[model samples]
Target chain A: MKFDDKIPIYYQIKNYIYRQIIVGELAPGDKLPAVRQLAVNLTVNVNTVQRALGELISEKIIEPQRGKGNFVTEDQGTIEKLKKLLITQQLQELYENLHQLNVTDTEIVSYLQDYIAKRKQVQ
Target chain B: MTNTIEIKNLNYRKNYRSILEDVNLTIESGKTVGLLGENGAGKTTLMRLIAGVAKGASGKITVANQDGVPEKKSVISFSEQLNGFSSNMRIDKIIRFYEDVYPDFSTKKYNEMAGFLQIDEGLRLSALSRGMKEKLVIGLTLSRDTKVYLLDEPFGGIDSMTRKKIIQSIIKWKSDDAVILVSDHYVSEIASILDEVVIIKDRTIYTQKSAEEIRSKYAEGIEQYYESIYEGNDIDD
Candidate 1:
């Protein structure tokens, strides 16, 4: 779990799991690590893990079966929806920053292409 | 294996002077336990004994064991009362040292904690303030993912802001099956968080019970409970 000093830890965990789902690393219907297991593995408090999981459940990214465990929801559309939600937030911030810098859409797209190329190479 | 801690007939003697007398106690796992005592009440010694740091202590300390014996490094994370880091070591270096020693140490967790704590990655430990250094030590210790955590006077010398951060870290570090033993004199700050309270007097475990149980049994909060015990009043009153 990569935590941000500026952001709440639960939000970070929620975003992390969402990213995993978007990247196809955590597939639909795959069960996540148990709350206790995740807490032990991440060294975060179990309550934090529970909070993260609960948020995911509410977001429809994961579903919990009573007495069983939480599983990734089978709906890819929901995943896409979450991804769009996060992207909108990022875009809003980017728009503000670019506007302050007086960067045009063309220049931003060119810069983004270069960034995407570099990221792909690293991956 | 249920999470439980039990000590029986524990005794420690140095120079024919009893450091800890026969003491028996049991603390169930998955709860926050506060060990309250004034200075020289053997809180550190008892924690050390539970952590297996002392070799000459005579007794059985059991954690989740039917036989009532703590397995080696099995049931404890004893943070020393004194700061134990090398003065010359870098902060990250000490973290790596603990990473190698404790099987459960997580680099990812350390990185995450570092970010949350907003600690400078490149600074040497000696460069940090006393409060920041304590936070760093606590972050490292709490990142061990251990079953039993023993923190000795973690709130000492730190400001209220740092203390709140430390407490939040503890809340995050605790698991459902873990037992956290925090030793401190600031009973008020910790009393709210503790599930159980243990008071040490004359080097022996004088009293132990859940916070609610203690309150119900004695009609007083943890502070008054300690006062009564120290004043030689019956705990059941």
Candidate 2:
């Protein structure tokens, strides 16, 4: 994955894995690549990969079993919560940008609805 | 026992011309450090000194707590010079020679790397391309289980595909307990694998920082940081 150099690499790595789960590229109980394999595939440092995986494990998004590699969480409830958390983060950024443009919260809601509705109509 | 390399007051002179002077740096094990500089910045000289292939003037270099000495040469594997091997030696014969000479050389690992890099056993060094020669050098260098691996511009004068293959081999074969120091003028090509970067300018180490720190602190990649340093607008990006 190409990383944005503005962000910490471990944070970007976590986002990449989170995105895999959110988009269903990684299903529940699906095995994650070994840490070194991921490191090599992504061209990232091994210690950085370890830190990212550690965060994922602690967050309960991915779990590690003895002798087996990490896997996506089988807990659907937790997965749903994580998905919501990610969406919320994106919305927060969008809202802040709009706010910087002097748009109100109500205006943001209306403009987003209008934009999406127009986009759907175009399709 | 330190698991680190310490360069203390190192200096190098060639034909009465000073190359590097009073250089000091500490590189810890497990880091893939990049030696970054423009041409004639003494990057190669520094690597050679660390490998103990060339002696420095009035200074000391210690790898894993031992001074830079002839016997300490065993601790370093250099990707540049395949000194004793003749031009006509086939790939397989060279591997055999390495296996017989360096007790640390792993024949099994070499075989695996040869297949992975698509290097034919029957190919001769004189017949190989620059990229292929680089791959061969990398394979031979990594097959030796040494404390330090110095790759001085292994990507220089090579094709991108071959550089990619060499990069992959590096990631796969590097020992977790040892360190790899790669010197390159092209920062972007090797930035992804680098843990830390040592910037050498004007014949000495100018600065050293982790790749992550450069990204976070400067809000830019290692390449941008290098550019900023050149533009005299350091940290603006």
Quote the TM-score that chain A achieves in each candidate: 0.82, 0.94
DockQ for the candidate 2 complex? 0.65
Per-prediction DockQ scores?
Answer: 0.02, 0.65
Candidate 2 lDDT at A51 equals 86
Residues A4-122 of candidate 2 have per-residue lDDT tens digits of: 76577998999999999989999999999988899889877787898899999999999999999999999999999999999999999999999999999999999999999999999
Instruction: Please report how far candidate 2 places residue B232 from its true position, in Å.
Output: 2.9
Error of 1 at B111 (Å): 2.3
Cα error, candidate 1, residue B160 (Å)? 0.7
| Runs with alpha carbons beyond 4 Å of true place in candidate 2 | B235-237
| Per-model TM-score versus the true fold | 0.63, 0.93
* lDDT by residue for model 1 (B1-237), tens: 364788889999878889999999888778778999988888888888787777587888776564323454744666772267767678777877877777887787777777777777578877888788778767777777777888988888888778767776776556668889999977766664577788898788877776655654555667777777788877443
What value does the lDDT take at residue B148 in candidate 2? 89
The DockQ assigned to candidate 1 is 0.02
